[model samples]
Target chain A: MIDLSTFLKEMISLPGLSGYESPVREPIARTWQPLVDELSVSKLGSLHGLRRANVKGDHHSVLIATHMDAIGLMVAGLDDGLLRVMSIGGLDLRILVGQMVTVHGKRELPGILQMIPDRLQDKSKAGSPPGITDLFIDTGLPINEVSDLVKLGDLVSFATPPQEMSGGALAGHSLDNRASVAALTLCLEEIRKFNLAWDVWAVATTQEEETLVGARTSAYEIKPDIAVVVDVTFAKGPGVTDYHTFAAGKGPTIGVGSNMHPALGKYFKTLADEMDLPYAMEYMPKSSGTDAMAIQVSEEGIPCAVLGIPLRYMHTPLEMVVLKDIQRTGRLLARFITQLETDTMEKIFGERKA
Target chain B: MKELIQKLCEISGPSGYENNIREAIKKEVTPYADSIEVDPLGNLMVRKGKKTEGGLRILISAHMDEIGVIVTHVEKTGFVRFGNLGAAFPWYLPASRVLFLNGTRGVINSEPREDNTKVSTIDQSYIDVGASSPEDCPVKIGDVGVFERPFMDMGTRVASKAMDNRSSCAVLIETLRQLKKSPHELVFLFSVQEEVGIRGAVTASYAIDPDLGIAVDVTSVGDTPSAKQMEVGLGKGAAIKIRDSGMLCDPRVVRWMRETAEKASIPHQMEILRQGSTDAYVIQTSRSGVPTGAISIPCRYVHSPSEVVDVKDLESSVQLLLKLIGGPVQLK
Candidate 1:
């Protein structure tokens, strides 16, 4: 049995916000290095780990991607020792306020996320809402020293550490995806013990929050015959009515829609149902908003699918994820990749049997 | 070269639905091809060499599709309500021209009665198919529509609709024409439905069982005014893919293309597209393993009513591909 929470805690301790993801990059890459065959970085900063299956003619290449990058802020301009910032990826302003952050300056400095009071919020003046200009981070440093140390484009990340809750749940800063990365790490570890066919490339994709660029470049590096993107999706809660049928504490979610290949979607759903693992379905009409969108269209186009862990308060400092979901998802991917051979895999999109 | 480019541009092959364009491309390449076949999904694969030899099996794919719209609903007042087949900026929709797959023409008109703010919101726009009633509408749901042809010469830049990828299709065509006897087992797969999801390449690459695949397509150029400060430039030459939002070209293959271009003195640049993906990504990872790369013809205003490209760049891409095909297939 894998101690998933322990690994999640270590991952959450690292502040890897989007473009400034150096802190978590090398550590996570090193974690999975012994389990994988070849580990390298693409032209982009995506960390790719390859594990070749022992079977001969198991020449199939499969990529399982989970972006290591997370949403946070970049120091655009310093104002009076306070950091004026830009959101590197999608930052829900509603959740960002009153959160703790770490300002990555010449050195890592602790900071608090704050905004002007509601009087300045101007609720009536709607449409596009307030820009990042309205929000500022206070690091408690002198203006002269702050300006000298922190220049524009300094990365800022949430300062939250991963913690286990009573009901098999974990809360952290980047549970939106780092939890998925942890799951991929578990998959890497488990596959090492088994003698499987096919080459599995476990990728900790970068820049997925900013853009799906990391998966794009990394997919090219792995050049897998089949690709699977693991990420997180919306978990329903109060005030979040416009969402999918996914719930927190569920095992995992399999994407099914136009963007998702029907065969791959059905295949995952069937496996989840047969294995008796709790799973839900989500519609990915155009783009899954995961690395799947990037991986699905790699050279000659990789037949792609997505496996997501339901997450609540996504893109927030206190992003929440369930523990069992990670373990189950990783197991499912390990089994799927191990079972893959050229013959059985070619039936990926072929007609179903009676 | 000019005639080939003109013919490729004139043909329409919208994403997810490409039949006529594949037929047209098949007729053109059939003479030089050893065996020609179109898959069930409509991907046209033209093979020129034998599978007997242990020579490299390479798939040179060019998407025969362009971005367009599908008629989702037809209003009672003879207007067609539609949605985009791929990513489309509404700024390019209103007052622009479109053509249906069945040769029926339509004009995209903004809802004049509504506020200008909602013009691009899909509901505030409809296609005018020159019909007075819903019964008179020639098109129906599932029918694909693409931008109407608009070819022009603006100084050195040639402007046209669907140049987003048709320019590269022309490049692929010219490159094949230049190679009378390919040195390797070549699969010239004129892929269908690329503007949508690169649907054609997915099927074609599987059938060819290619050891290496190269997607010839269009990339973004920064030479345009206020463009995203891209290192790639128009007329500078063809672009060897290093990294893009799709797939990264095999480093050894990229080095080979660059070396081939530089040694032959064919002007070429390396592209680093951040937000967009290409067919190379799908081809690169197909089946078990196949080394894949892309050579893109840089174009301006991708997926818009009017796209622009430099003919000099198109010729350079063709020339570089010619060098690759004419010589031995080498993989590092």
Candidate 2:
């Protein structure tokens, strides 16, 4: 069995930015290899780990999706020697000024994000954060040497290593869905203690942050009767305290939104309540911004429910999550999967007898 | 007030993504407000003061939303092409840091041009988080990013991004914290989506349907070098709105504000803003037409990343509100 903290740290260290999830996918596939019966990779680079059901009748599969991509930057051009970059996900420019990054050029090069000095910039804009143009990657190597190593369209990722904070909190980049990925792994491990009836397709989806391509396509191919999307949500911390963000370490968030089926969400909420696990229902008025959005609309439509692990400083290099929440989320999901009956599909989306 | 403003300014709540800001305001005002409720569109409407029978009902509004950028496309090379969510100036965006609600941080930069011509539009610019390829980028198309500058206490003045309305929210929060009693029913509205199209204020004002509406928002000043010739100036007290680019202030509402400021001896200046409007404009047109006016905070660099506001002006705006609504609305 893999240690949760060690697994999460290794996941964060991998460079699996959207569309480019191969680097991270390799380890995920390896981790899922022993637990799943059949393993396959999607055309768009999504990883599929299938746990077959033991039932004698027709098989019903449940797709569990957690996006594996991390937000990062791409080299747009090289000016003099420094790389001109662009955002791959939602980048907070304020945190970019002094952030350390790794430029994946011909070879991995260590660099510091160099913001144009306040003295050289206009007074009106001085001390004000500069745009990406006014910023460049300083590799410390000579200009010609830097030019030789870096190329246009190279990838740059936050190089901040994972930190184990006080309490049971873990902080690092790519925790958004990677933490959820860890949760899915724990769910698979939990299922080993029970004989489940429904097939479980643990999918490490691609491009959820950039596009729902991985979820949309994977769901269509697998055609699961139900889908449970696990992802990280905002945790109450400095500067973020609203209904949209839940408290970290308290519990996971069950999503209620356009993408979530009412019955499906209610079941998860009831399950959490039944087990005395801490959970909150996040209201998504429109798009849930998860793989469930894609899975819900796939083909004839599948009932989807989103489960979120509370994360602090999401998307930044220092995104933090409580290991307890990940374990709790995994336990709840495992219990829910084991409780699924043959008529569970009818319970989720069948017509009522009025 | 400074601490409150700083706290509010740091929260990232772009249009359609105001839950974080809404939560901050809700927590602060929960103890003082009579009842607090969030509308379907994510508007935090707080009812305060005393409920008087047939007495005046005044609504004080401040938008909680800020200008942002929505990722439109992510290039194969991992550069994210984006569209402006509100009125984020292209020139100001270059070298500015933007953050997604999830904390994905990236800097906005224009694509290099061989001709050395600066990229003037949003399309020519992209967000850089240093991903090497499309697969390497963590951002997806349609993810929203807002300015992520920190609050700075510049002695007498404070500077920060999203202060355009977060500062106003601080004013409303402070007003709620200070006001002990009121003769009229006061509905303090912390609205959303103001930066995009004043969407939240419109829906919120329609629901309240108050007799009078007053919006507290930051207004631009011509205080900088060779700036446009505008009457509003930073540190010159609150700018009492006469009219702006959005709506003409109700003459009666304007008169009411002016006399109240004078009687209370609150420092204020008459403002004839030639551009931009506030939540007041939308509220003024809600229901059977509300007599709406705005108390403008004279701010330099209205929508830029580093918005400057005089702390004195923030205090005066709070005093003026406390004087006007701490008692009955006497608009005769």
Candidate 3:
């Protein structure tokens, strides 16, 4: 049996910003090697693990993609021994002040991300949130040592360790995506015992935080008959209890919008109901802001669906998720894969009965 | 053509919810198309002409989506709070009527400030659906609504809610019906979600991988009072686009469109829109890059409920498109 909590904690501890995921990919490849039959990497460095169909001459394939990149900061310039940084992805800069970070420079250096004092700031900009120009990373070292250790264009990642909270929750940085990676891992492990009719491609895509390059390129290479993109969604937290958010501990969400195929979404909802799993229908009127957006449009166009794990404090260092929701999402994916028949495309396309 | 424009503009399809409109358009083009397929992103691709041995693959596109509002919250007083799907300006929203896909109706209004100031943001506005409370309210969170104005045939100019692109859609439909024979392969794409972004064209063009591309859509004109400085006006025939904010028209494609218009003696004008773009921007940048240009119908008050377009301009656009795509297109 796979321990979900331990796997997630180990994955989140690694530093893998967008477009640079080797640090995290090495361990993920090792964990997924035993669960899959054939493993390869895409040209853009997306990990593709294929488990061929057990009982079929020629079978269709389904790509289950989960982005493994996280948002962080990069050194833009050196400002008098302090590192002036730029954000790699969408980040709420308001919560970035006074946070711990590990600057990946010539050597691993511990630093604190801080904003200049209001007294030192310009008179016109005081009492407002600091912009990227106003923020810096201090390593508590002398100017010569700091300048020698850190170079421009180095990566800086959040150093907050994953913490286990009461009620089966985990909080840390990179939980926006690493949690979904864990869920995909669980699905791969669970589907090992099933005799599936369709080939399964578990893709740990890269660059979803900044550009969807990984999802876009991988889908073109795989050319699967269908795809399901897994990612995290907003959870109900302090000051965020709208319909767009779901309860963290309750279940995952099945996306319903233009990005998702309606028949595929209904099929997931039916399986979830049969398995007695609680889930929400997330309505994304435009972009789902997930890997599905790119995967759905690749090549001749593959029918795609999005599965979301409810998370709290997205893009923050202390983002949180319920461990139970990850397991539920994993089980739902396993059930769907096992239940797919050779003629499942007809049902997915709403052409004829299976 | 005016009736088709009204028919297409009246259907309710915001950026993401394009099912009804897609079905309606598919019905109109089913007889003329050789093959039709709806891509995963809801882009309807219709192939009209057959491919010969060395024929060029051409894609002409027009987006089928419009700007609207999506409900974000339903208050206890039966009023709903919403967000814009595609540039639903707050100043154009108040006192406007809207219709949801499920036949629900509502009127948009803003909260009065204590200091009696004007509401300048969407957060200050709400929609009243004639319900006394949330229990009786037919509107739910995530329901999308578009402007609920009937189409008006104002002499030579037509006014409607979604005339920004539906006028172009009508132009494409007429072009498909009129073109007799062609040596090159033609793909007429009725794309989705162009209002949110040029999303549908990005995927559809990648799938089609055309040799050359043309986008038919509406453009802002200087005919309105004190409008931004522009040379194109309402009745200025077909506007051959040179540049927009999103893309610079492929120079070769621009020259070809202008030369084709002049050779045919179509009432044409050169257009250089300072803002906004069309599907040609993405189709030009599709896989390995395709040389692309656009034919824009001049309109006024774009993105507003009652966008106005001249019938003469629509006819000229259809004529230029037929002449351009009805024969072999050689970029060299």
Candidate 4:
């Protein structure tokens, strides 16, 4: 069994921005090595761990893709020792000031992402939100030393430590996806003891934030008959009480939209109901904003579904996810995998006998 | 072509919910395409000339989705808070009449601004569905509504919602109908979720991996009243794109398209769109890479419900595509 709390903190503590995922991929590869039968890396740097089915006859495969990349900043230029930065993903500039970060340069340096004081700017422009050019990372070192230590294009990840909140919620940066990765990890651990009818491919896709490159290529390479993508959705919190956001600590969400296959979605709902697990139905209507977007259209087409973990404060430094939700998502994935039969394709494609 | 444009633009299909528009396009191109498949992402992949062996693969793409609003909250008194499905501005949203997918009507309005310190984002806006209470209203949370605009025939100019790509869609459908026989294999893709990002094109491009990719979409025009300085204009025939915010057209493809338009006696102009991009951006970078260019139909007031495009410009775009893809042409 995996300790969810320790694994989550260790994963988020590493610096793996969208295009740069090695720091986080190394730890995940180590943990998933013993659980999977074969492991390989894609040309785009996505980590794939395949577990062949124990069944004797012809078998298809099901892929469970969880993006391991986290949103962070890249060094754009040097501004008088203060590093100018650009967002690597969808970042709201409003929440970036005064946050703690770890700058990966010559050596790791603890720094604070800061903005010029409000009083220093012109009065008319003061009320307006500061643009990316106005924000810089202050490392508290002298100009010459800062220039020598940090170079251009260095990755800067949020350094907020994981905090255990009341009622078993884990709060930290990168929980938007690392939490989903943890859930997939838990699913892999649970399925190791079972005899599945289909082969299982657990992929940690990369660059899902900037582009769907990793997921698109990996899905094309694997050519799985079915794919279920696990990603994070907005959780209900302060200023986030809308139908678009789900209730945090409730359960995982099953996606419904053009991107999600109806049969695959129905299976997840049916499984959750049979197991008496709490889950919500998220209507994507179009893009699920997950790896399923790419996986669904790989090659000819693949029946794709999405399982989303409700996460609060997505794309921010202090994201939060309920620990119980992660466990429930993992259990749901395991149960769904066990239920797949050789005729599952017929069932999913609506060829089932009446 | 006008009837097809009006038929497509009148349907209500936002970024993620492209079912209505997809069905309409499927019915229009069913007779022309050799085979048609709706990808899992809701992109209608229609192919022609599949019998040609070892032919150069060409992909022509146009997005079917338009910008709209998704219901975020339904208040007890029937006031609904909404969020944008794609790129939307609060300045253009006030007092716009919208219709939901389920046939419910609403009017978007905003709270009175006492000061300008805060940005007037979508959060400050709500949709009034004219119900005494939430129970009396048919709208629910997560329901999407598109601007309810009727297609208009402004003499030579046509105007409607979603003309940004529906205009291009009409061009694609017309091209399919007009092309005689092409030695090169052709794939026409009506991509989805393009309003949110250039999302549907990424997978569609990877699936096809065509030798040449051309996205057909609308481009901003400089002919409008006090419009931002752009070289493109309405009634300028087909706009051969050179640069945009998201992509730089491959020089070889650009040269080929320009030569084809000139030699075919099609009225054409060059486009350097300042801000937005089309599906060609993502398709150009797929796999190793595919030489990509875009044929833009010049339009005014893009992303608004009342976008305008010249009918002659639409016809020219269709003719240009037919000339380029009617036979195999060398990329080198």
- Per-residue accuracy of model 2 over A21-46 as CA lDDT, tens digit each: 88899988899898889999874568
Query: Every model's DockQ, to 2 decimals?
Result: 0.04, 0.01, 0.02, 0.04
lDDT of model 4, residue B130: 91
Which of candidates 2 and 4 is the stronger one according to DockQ?
4
Deviating ranges (above 4 Å) for candidate 1: A1-354, B51-54, B117-119, B180-182, B328-332
> Runs in model 2 with CA error above 4 Å?
A352-354, B1-332
Model with the higher TM-score, candidate 1 or 3: 1
The Cα error of candidate 1 at residue A49, in Å, is 11
Candidate 1 yields a Cα-based lDDT of 0.78
Instruction: Provide the overall lDDT of each model, using Cα atoms, as 2-decimal numbers.
Output: 0.78, 0.85, 0.88, 0.87
lDDT of 2 at B6: 92
lDDT of 1 by residue, A176-238 (tens): 788899888888887777876677888888778865767876776667777888999888787
Ten residues in a row with the worst lDDT in model 4 chain B? B243-252
Off by over 4 Å in 4: A352-354, B1-332
- lDDT string, candidate 4, B1-332, tens digits: 78888998998889999999999999999999999999889899999985376468899999999999999888877898999989876777878889999999989888878885654668988899998677988898899989987899988899998897899999999999998998888999999999899899889988998878999999988777776646578997899987565655665688799889999999998776657899988886687456689999999888887999999999999999999998668753
| Candidate 3 chain A lDDT trough over 10 residues, lowest sum | A345-354
List the lowest-lDDT window of 10 residues for candidate 1 chain A. A345-354
Which residues of candidate 3, in runs, are more than 4 Å off?
A352-354, B1-332
